[model samples]
Target chain A: MLDNPYHNKTLQWLAYAAVFLLIGIVPLLTDDDFLLNQLATYGVYGLLAVSISLCWGSGGILNLGQGIAFGLGAYGMAMTMQMQSQAPGTIPPFMANNALETLPIFWEPFWNTGLGIALALLVPTLFYLIFGGLMFVARVSGPFFAIMTLAILSALATVFVALQPYTNGVNGISPPTGLVIAGTKIDPYSSTAYWLVFALLLICTFTAKLLTQSRFGLVVRALKDDPERVRFLGYNVAVYETLVYALSGLMAAAAGASFAVLTQYVSPAQFEVGFSISAVIWAAIGGRGSLLWAMLGAFTVQGAQSYAGDAFLNTWILILGFSFILVVRFLPGGFAGLAELLLGRLASLRGGRREEFGQAPAKGAAK
Target chain B: MANALILGISIASIFLVAAIGLTIIYGTAGVINMAHGEFIMLGAYATYAMQTYFGLPYFLCIPCAFVIVGAIGFVIEKLLIQYLYHRPLDTLLATWGVSLVLIQGTRLTFGSDPKYIQMPGFLSSNIELGGVSLAAFRIFVILAALALIALVWFVFYKTDFGIKVRAVTQNREMAAAFGINSKQVYSFTFAFGAGLAGVAGALFGVLNIVLPTMGTGYVVQAFLIVVTGGGALMGSAIASIATGEMQSIFAMLLNDSFARFLIFILIVVFLRFRPQGLISAGGSRR
Candidate 1:
């Protein structure tokens, strides 16, 4: 079934490694803090896109409220960094500015850096597990699952905006000074921060890619194709889906935590439905079935937006919306699909007999 | 206390109008349109354009908005949605893309500032009964909601088009086999739904600021009603009334934000126990 050019094992791994090599060597080429920070943001977004691809594309779990978990991670680290920035015996600056006398109980645990980071990952994981377990066990799939997550994200954004004293309201809370943990500080606009984000993105991409190549990954692909068939084969469909869903939460939170450290802010706007939907767009543009391409999709779109923000301003999003429609309608495989077509042509041109799987249809390229 | 119930019913009516468009499209065409909100937004924008340019009365703008937005919807379905009748997920993504285009397009045209539609002098006043007090416009909105529900009922049940729509919704191939042009039914149904949303936008423009992004706020609530109602007209009405009342009462006890949060959680939990919703569409995909 894995006879297609997109799933060519050796070539994919090599391409993935080459991209990481290029990413890792960027710092050596430039001392521009602005550029590094921008790239670091891409790496964080890359992690997020990969997670979305893992669950939404591969596992067939359409989670539209992923930004909530992303926000949870951002807030988790921000709470710690916010506490760190305060004077001894005083509340965080945001809370102090809002006239809060004591820290909220939830914010108390985040004062310690370790607990803050741990909770950043742990809390979102638990949330995904419980939420996914509930939905999947009940056999809810497809559009209903997608819409529910969208609703939850929008509801959470409203709640976050309302919790002005705690969430710092619409303007958001920023710990711009960066984070210090165990005597080592991760500066917001430094090579160290960039390297950290870059390294994590690579690790996450590699691990997730490997996971997708495992036996478990095969089941997920099968499940995505036909959940009933997977279930009939004696596989616990809900457990498998819920597990991957929780893993996606972990990855997203990690990215969010890094985002907090790199950007030094967490806002109610980050929890907005648009934020999560854009992540979906990135995954879709990159080809959701391929992790590397999905991350690259984030890099490409976000990079374009960042560069085009000033000149185009209003027209950028209008054009982007149009592009998204075209991609959805015509280019379902996205950049990955384009790459696959080229590879297939190259193979055919060589007058070589391509490995043909007897039972696999051409549509099952990723299988 | 009783005042809250009155307010709740009023809010429920508004939600029902906003969601009816979405429910109709989903029911008749089996589409999950993410651009449903944008269609409603276009409706409000159409109303605003009429008032600002022609100095059209608030009451008269409703039908104008309906026709303008519904025509746009009809054209959109013919051009884009017709190709995606079988793919719900693709339809959603495509509609979302359409929504983005519409939002940005409107923003480009109107700018981001809030616009206002002048209501009649009587609607600007308030109606008071015993201890309860509410805006005359709010009361007007409530009546308008009821009118929309009744109008929709009449269309869906009493007309030949309704039979065609229902036939296609139940079984598309069979409907097609029975000399019913399912495609035409879908386009008309989509246009009708869009018209309803346009009316919703015209009403909502008076209640809130008429901004490009206003549809977003209503859209979530609309989806909540639809999901809770199980994607059927009767179910959507019952769900809207129940959720609206519950939200209002909860807000009375706590706060609006918390009340909304509670409703969201309650819906999620409610769906867990009954994924079919407050009213299931039997074994059909709602």
Candidate 2:
């Protein structure tokens, strides 16, 4: 039975590959720009879901501050878009409005997309590197980890709210005019933008899968199971944990950049504690060990909420919360394990009936 | 100066009541009870419903709100929290879900608008001392919170029931072997803690807008208080009042958000130095 576990895993990979190809070709089958826009949004969420899975599922890090990393990414990308859209040789609108005679020194570097993208990865990774390093080194695990991260998020939110000159103070930043990709002007609502988002999602998903299959992945899982044992094995568990955390932050930031491009706006609301909590629910519902399950869980929950409409939107949180409880209670192995269990049961039932009836001349012959 | 002091005391009183209940549960059960804020919301709404719908006098509705909200807490403990006694992480998530349900239910029923519970004629009156006027309700809140604290102290340190509760909190298995019904103690303790939160909520609603999302704001503050206070009932009360007074004074001097940020930074720094907390030395870290 264990020998064929890889067989099921291969089948699962194929199924996910098929879904990815279908989504990639969606714009080709439809002329509806609105549909493509919605799919792009889903792709952004998928990136986030995968990022969350990499950390929480594989790294045993319950980061309730995924939104903070995302906000960093969104703010980074949005700042560049804002700077690029200003009149040639003129300051951005906010600085212009604030009576600043010259462009701020900080805003100067973001004019280059390369710098902005680099910062998007660096900022969140650095934030996590410092914070996660401190906590893990201090031996803060479990609920304390959750609370400390939440405290960091609260601080970030307050900073965002207070720094009106930079963050616009709760109003958040919107992408300025058109998105410039490698000097090519692209409408945020265009199919090209959607395709770009899809490509990024593929890259993130593939990278996450690769990370999970590597030797580092084995060490991380071992740390999760027995931290003392890993320490005894002469591995620097804190460094490994921090590295995985920074990687997760980078992935989250990448997703946030895509989200900013797709939505054309970014706000404090996007990084609220609710968003972070929902990510936890997604990770839990998708099953913690499987990347495919995490993505499927995100798609299922988000798709359900979208289909349920605006009237039910407010109640979507309650639904998600209850779903977390249900998943924890009834499906401890989550949707992925549950699917495998059902399939196995059906196969066993068929074999048993076949033995009872002496195969019954093989119902439905190949010929 | 007198008015500011009075306002500070009133705010501190609210925190004291909320943080005490939170500390009790955290200290004894090692459960953070994130839904404690929701219980406060329930209490506030219960009082609002009583006064507005039942036409009860505001004074009469206070105890009634406590009973109604306390019953809700009891039911929640018996039905949901009991199953999660051995599972802290699951308990946290489940209670979070319960809090969402409560908030959404309130939004659905109350239409998301802030509801006002009119202060009684006595509480609406103000007392003047040396040209400084203080709201009578503020005085009442301070006194009531103090009385509640005194009562809790007596129960916890001066009674057999309190001893059993504390014993179970210290070690459930050992206490059970010693003929203590840990299950019963857990239910009663959770219900009692939740009841205190409810009363805090009802009383606090008078000082602020009673809204569906009001609990969300208090939840973090309560956690900060519980952590800072040392995860014990006395420590939480003292820390909460101190923090509350500090915050109010800071807010009076600086921007409210800035004051909050400073306090949070202080707490984080304090945790770095003494992670076991201010009240409970060697307590299990939640």
Candidate 3:
């Protein structure tokens, strides 16, 4: 089942290492803080794309609430930084404006950076565990599961906006500057920040890839193929799915936290249904079943979006929508599949066995 | 209490129109169109274009919107949905792309500015019953919804095409074996569904601001109704009415945002217990 050329274990790890090195050195290669920030943004997006792939591609659960996970991270960190940006003892200005004499109980814990990060990961994971667990145990899958996640995203976005005092309304929570952890101040556009994001991206990618290639991933993929058969084989399918979903939420939260630091803001827009759907598109176009390809696809598509924003005033969305359709319809393997085909052709010309490397024995390739 | 009940029925009427199209498309083709909302958006745009450029009356815009959107749906079904019928997920993704194209394309042409359709003077006024006052437009919406539902019921139950559609929906290969052109039925059914969305859009344009993103707002509710309804006409009708009434009652008791949040939560929990929806069709692919 792992015979796909893109699933070549050594080649994948090498690709992972190579991509990490390339992105890690990008800050050093460029002195422009703007470019560095953009790279950091892409890295954060890469983390998000990898999260989507981990759950949807390998675990057979299409989580469209990924933006909520990402936004929870951003909101968590933003709340911390927003408090930190003010004087030590004063309530957040927004809370004061809302006529509160003191910080809300929820906001009190986020004042600590460590608590912020922990909450970022814990909140989203717990959300996924409850939500995904309920759906999975109820035996919801396929289109029904997909739409339910979308509902979560829309509902979350709305709830964020409606909870004005805590969420700062639709204007969102924006700290004037980057976060301070212990005695270290994080400057968002600085090389250090870029490296931090790059490091997080690397950690997320490697861990996700490792998970998807592991025995647990194999069972998840098998379960995705036929849940009843896996159940017949004595596996608790819902538990495995819930675990992977929660793990994906953890990764998304981490990305979202770092993303807030990079952007210096957290808006309800971050939790928009469109934003979550974009993550799905990135995974789909990257190679839904492959973590490495999905990460690359995020970078590639986001890079194109950034570049296209400058070149085409409004046609970029049209082009993106069209490409998304074309990819789903004609190029189901996405850019990763195209790369695999090219590599396979090259290997075949050099007298290698094409079938073993080029074509996966089954559609579930990563496992 | 009567006022709230009346308000709920009015809200339910609009949702019923929006959800009916979705139910038909999903019930017939088993395609969960992500672009369903976009089609409704296009219908509003069509109405706006007709009223502004062609000087078509607001009442006349309904059929015009329906025909134009239905034609677009026909073209889409022929060009794209036809190929994706075998893959439900692909249909979801591809239709999402279609929605993006529709939304962006509309934005490019019409810009992001909100547009409105001028309702007739009567619809613009209010009627008093006892001590309660209701907008004439809301009553019109309710009557229009009832008319459309009746039309759909008549079409589906009292026509040969309806039988063909039901047959094809139940078993495509068997229907084909019985000399029914399932493909044609699918195309017609898709077009009909799109037409219903167009009418919904036309009505919504008056009820709310008509913008490129308006469809999304309605589409979410439509989805809730359709999903809860289990993709059937009767189911959608009942679900929409129940949801609308509950939303109104919730809003009356709590604030609007909290009410909506509660509804969304309830729907999710409801789905947990009844994933097949309020009613499940037998022989459905489990």
Candidate 4:
């Protein structure tokens, strides 16, 4: 009825499945523990990129302060893990170093692992619901929304720095390189940690895929095309937009939580505008139109940086900037578009109807 | 107390100068111009290069920086911004890309080192009046801001070109039907805005260190000014003055960074209540 709402849904899902499978088997295929850990780290980043695509791509919301969501999640995990390492009522190490007499009141509840994980997902969602909801309800969209998010990113990072007593200042909160349970320190670098990250990535990818394919997703996609038409059709556009913003926040928080567990650290840098812009760039390069490609784009960019950044630290940013321009100007479909073209050509040569695989009319959301 | 007040005005003037160009470009072209700060950065670098290599005086570097950066802005408008005017978000991202390229290009050329422009001796001296001592350069900046504001007013309100820009901005199709070339108006307005940014940069280089990344530091404030001002000359001026004074007073009472944080929070709250900013330009709210 919606004209096959999803373009090549079967093929897209298959592509996602194949990529997930490939990610899943990497650890098993390689004896290199270091490489495994690196990919695991990238797996967390990939989740952030997917969250960007989920909002900017599917939901037609460009949230440039996505790092703030990640930062909230990471800080949640870091605080919990930090408290776990310390005896009850003792000041955290960083605070103690700063000569704070006691642990801050906010840090008191984070001692519980369950509360920490809950807060990791909840804090960012709450922020997005309120912040994004206010903007959407007030009918502020387009570049204005983008700038507001950018401002939030800048402000949040500075706030993190200014609130040094709670955030450990610019030095950030780094937990010990282990998980604390009851009274024992457990190695976080173990295979269990790696698998945990991989599992979360898998869950998030599938969850997003499922969510974007639902009836609500259809309405949301329609909202992107024409808000007036959707509103006239009796949909509360603000509530739906806010819900998608919160969902994106949840995804980002998940990535942040995993990032803290993997790195044993949470820094104010996570809230930086550069970090947020990188997520946007990843989404654009991977084609904001597809969540799977967005995830791949993050991995590709991060992987390339890991390998080439050491030698061309300065040139890397220039290259990234240029590629972003080229993509936006000439290849709006991004890497996903390139893939679709190749596959479509192959299908046509095999005598398939062109209309069946034709590119859907570009949505009005971004294009 | 008086010193702090003067200091506030000086800070406001810097934001006002940088924001004016943004206000004009955005108000006329409906383009957000994300590279506004980078244009400022280019101006500073351009001044630094001229001063060091060509033995150009600081006074002369201001106009030279304008022409140099204005040309670049003109080229950007013609090559990139023209295509994305219909798509606001794409223009935002494309301009962001342009900013990144400009910043990194400057870094590669200038090697990330901070450069300073030499000040005229009289301008660098401290001026004392009524028990308040202020840097002469600060006074000059304030004067320059007032002068530029007056100049912009004269150009926008009185000139034939200003009428063309206004005509195009008000109703593009009608303006075109009336034989005005919207394309040239957009290009000139963009370049003029960019030239203003370059002048702000030349002034800023004297106040602080000039680095490729320095644009970032000023761009946020400039953007806030433009947004709060609602993308109008008067609105931007009032917004910059308000934010500048608020920041200075807060800094006097609290830490500088804390003051900034508070101002940003206030802006967020203000935007939530008034997303169209302090002044709405009527009709479409794009």
Candidate 5:
């Protein structure tokens, strides 16, 4: 009988689970508020990263306009918070600056927190539903899909900049006072905010894990591998693509909400093409197919940029650009694949025998 | 009204020149060349460097700009893009990186502030046609753009090299099997495209502020035009002028932001109905 002590897939999953748990608690162990705050920001970015991985990796749909979804979420949250901070029945600072005498029609519904969150998630989802439905139904894929999403992003940014009365143009909207939770004020910069973000990150990751392991995930993977084959099997490929795209947009909105609560400000600059491209870089740098790796990639890349300070700050774009090149050139499987490759090599060195773990090691390694 | 027409034509002329180059390369190579805008930036900077730093005459500096920037494009194709043709996404990523590097490099070499390109004395005066007055330079820019287009048309439709280029664009492997030098044609075509963008930049440098970040905005507009025009050289030329006229007329009637929103909505709707574009050349996968 073959020695199979190390062949349990559950143990492999547990190992990944443990790493994520440790990452979750790192803020609690550290006493530094700044570090904790940074971790919280990374948690928000992690949420977005997971969103990208879920749709792009599993569905083989690379969305280059994720920033728009993030912007929708941020704006939704910011509008609500702004409404709350105002004296009851008074115009908010943004509206006042724009010389609006009365509350805008759209701002009326966002007065309630529940409605705000729902709108934040629903707006991006609906936007994707219409866009994804049209594009997916037409069988748009590859570079065409990338370009179309980019066009949508460009249009969205332009609209935000042009609609100064509502969006404050380039000035963007600011967060209200710290988040109010059941009569207790929670300072966004406080440890409590960090814990809330941490909880959301965990929930997002678990949800993504559950999703990727489901039958739907299998269908998505199947479509990625061979669209025609999946179609022949009587699967509605367009529906699958649209659902994944909408789900990804929803997750992106959630991340944006967390970001607004954390940063307390939202701007048109935040939704630039560069921001969308950065999400792609994050997913590309992390192994695309793996959720934990995507989060790790987001955290590590963003953390490095944050710690690098002003001198290295301007060079961040160049660094990201080159990092993307290097990753694409050598580490086609991204960091996760690199790690798995190293582990495989180490395993081979330990015993002069080949071992198989979780699907084929080579399959899905190229992203 | 005449001045508005002149201004619209001048704006359309600059976009037409750049868009034509972009369409040619995109159609032939199936490469989007995200760095196409960077070439325009390079041209603008090259002209600035020659005129300001080297003390060259305005007329002499413009052609120099084209040559220098075209050379850069040639080098970029041979060193970077040639290897990336197999992987379209990789090309997009790598060129995007190149664009960032070029923009920052320009910002570092020349300060982030906008630079001015002085117009020659002859091209500076206003000429009156009927009751309306138009800048002499604006008329000259339109004429120059038309001349360039005519020249390109002649080269493509009236020469063996053009035939080979079209053949290669239609089928690269088949062209190679037929003993056509497809690689050389690609390099030359890319260089030609960059040269056109350079010319557009040189002309635009006189009409507008030349800044490192200016390329991004224009490039996005050019991209929209290319997609709207059906990704063909003729399509881009006609669509660019039409789009410019629409934008200009809309701007006259409405706020700039509202006009922009209207155009965006129209493009989105247009794309929904005819994803292949108004004048698709039949080879585009989209």
Candidate 6:
């Protein structure tokens, strides 16, 4: 019997490698720009899922406002890219739309692409780290953390929209042209954007998997299960928590930047409550416990959305809403857990094991 | 400045009414009902239905919304929330699912267009006192909030049913052993909370636009108040007033949205320093 197939790292890596190989070769086989764009967006979404898995799944810090970081990243990338196309003296498009004559002081820094990218990732990471640090150091655990993040989510949703001149309000902001790197211009629909996002997605998942497998990851898991006990064991749980939260924010911001490049648009829409909640849903569905599965979970949901198209968006939400409930309530371990269970079943069947009644080992099914 | 204080109190009352239901459910049952906002939305929709379809007046629609949304809450408790007790994280996610379903369902039923509730002509007018002038509807809302809080306080302290609820709140296992049906208490408490949110929605519908998504905005405020208050009636009462005054004062000092951002930042700092809140819901196992 496969007593615990989930912890079998070899099987996980094999699956991951196969998926990565498939993503790599698909572009070579396909000529459709739309397909390439969609896949690129999915790759960015994979980063979002990986972030959630790291924080909520692995670190036990159910950050409901991860999308805030994602939006910040998108703004960072889009603003920097937008500057590449505009005149040096001119204001940002959104600021100009509001009839502001002078470019905002903040926008000036983003004109330098390297500084913008670094700031985009670092700022959100710092924000999330500080926020998580405050909450955890004060011993705010579980639902309180969730509630506070949720409050941040709703607040950011409004705050982003309220900052219309900067965010361009509901209409959203897109760069007038593709980002020019050296002599190469990267169009969102091109194979280059697809490969870039796909590479980042891989790097993010690998880094997360490494972290989760290391001693830091061990403490993170312990922190999730019983934080007080972890603290009692003389571990600085708050530092561990803050680090993971910052890491999650960094990953989310990277994905958001990828989104700005891959989709060529950024807006308050990314800061909406729906976007934040969807991150949780993806992690939940994909198997928050497994970093790879969580990324796939994002891919699965985003793929479904593309298939369904924008017309039935509400219908998609309705379906995901029900799935979210059922998964959380009945299938807490989600798809990865289910896969492990099925594998265990198959192993038992193949092994012809005759375990005594009441002797079946608990598989840690729903932690 | 006095006018702003009154307005702050008015906003405070609105927050209290909005949060009372959430406090009751979380305090007693320990379920952080994320769907609490959806119930608020349902309440508004119920009031709209009664007024538009049944041709009922706004005054009568309040009770109708209470009953209607409360019944829905009861059904939801029986079907889903019952399975989720003691599992706080699961309950949070499940209730969030419920909120999503409720929001999309409402949007599907009501369409995306904004709906309006017709209040009486008197409520449409403004009341003048000294140098202050405020909407009569605001005064009505304040009175409604006070009346609701008083009634909830009375229910929790004055009745036999209230004792059962308090017992359950203190210790569900002990309450069960003492022959108090804790499940029944939970069901009733959840229903009452939902009904309170219904009342909040009915009032807020007039105060803001009646959209399918209106509850999203209020839910954040409601949550902040509930947490700051430490999930007790008096805690919520004091917390709401404090939050409202801070918000009003910040708004007066800065721009409106800037004030909101500052309030959020302040709330986080406040919670970081005092996660147990201004007043803890004491003598109970969290």
TM-score of each model, in listed order? 0.96, 0.91, 0.95, 0.95, 0.92, 0.96
Tell me the chain A TM-score of model 5.
0.91
Q: In candidate 4, what are the lDDT values of residues B1-286, reduced to their tens digit?
A: 6767777898899889888888888888888888998999999999999999999999999999999999999999998989888888888888889999999999999888788899898898888866678889988999999988998899888999999988888789999999999999999999999999999999989988998987876667778888888877888889989998988999999978888888988887898888888886534636
lDDT of 6 by residue, B46-157 (tens): 9999999999999999999899989899999998999999788889889999998999999999998999999999899988865779899989988998899889979989
Q: What lDDT does candidate 3 reach at residue A240?
A: 94
lDDT of 5 by residue, A227-263 (tens): 8899999999999999989988988999998898888
lDDT of model number 5: 0.80
How should the candidates be ordered by DockQ, best one leading?
A: 3, 1, 6, 4, 5, 2
Candidate 2's residue-wise lDDT over A1-367, tens digit each? 2122323657766876987898889888987888788878878877888888888778777777788899889888888788778766887666556567787787788878889878877888898888788778766666666777777677678878887776777888876676687789867677988899889888888777877778998888787667878999999988988888888888889888888877778888766877877777776788766776787788777778788746688777677767776776567557876876666656556665667756433432321
* Alpha-carbon runs more than 4 Å astray in model 3: A1-4, A346-367
Q: After superposition, how far is residue A98 of candidate 2 from its true place, in Å?
A: 4.3
Query: Candidate 5 falls in which docking quality class?
Result: acceptable
lDDT of candidate 3 at residue B76, scale 0 to 100: 93
**In candidate 3, which residue pairs clash?**
none
Give lDDT tens digits, candidate 2, residues B1-286.
Answer: 5555656777788778777777777777777677888888988998899989999987787788778877887898887888887766667767777888888888888878899988878778888755667788878888988988897889888999999987887777788999999988888888888878878877888888899888876777788888778787778877867777777888788867787888887777777677667767334434
Provide DockQ values for all models, in the order shown: 0.77, 0.47, 0.78, 0.71, 0.48, 0.73
- Each candidate's number of clashing pairs is 0, 4, 0, 1, 0, 0
Q: What are the per-residue Cα lDDT tens digits for candidate 1 across A173-216?
A: 88856799788888778899998998889888899989999999
Query: In candidate 4 chain A, what residue range of length 10 has the lowest lDDT sum?
Result: A358-367
Candidate 6 TM-score versus the reference? 0.96
User: Could you list the iRMS of every candidate?
Assistant: 1.1, 1.9, 0.9, 1.4, 2.1, 1.6
Q: List where candidate 1 sits over 4 angstroms from the true fold.
A: A1-3, A352-367
In model 5 chain B, the worst 10-residue window by lDDT is B1-10
Candidate 3 lDDT score relative to the true structure: 0.86
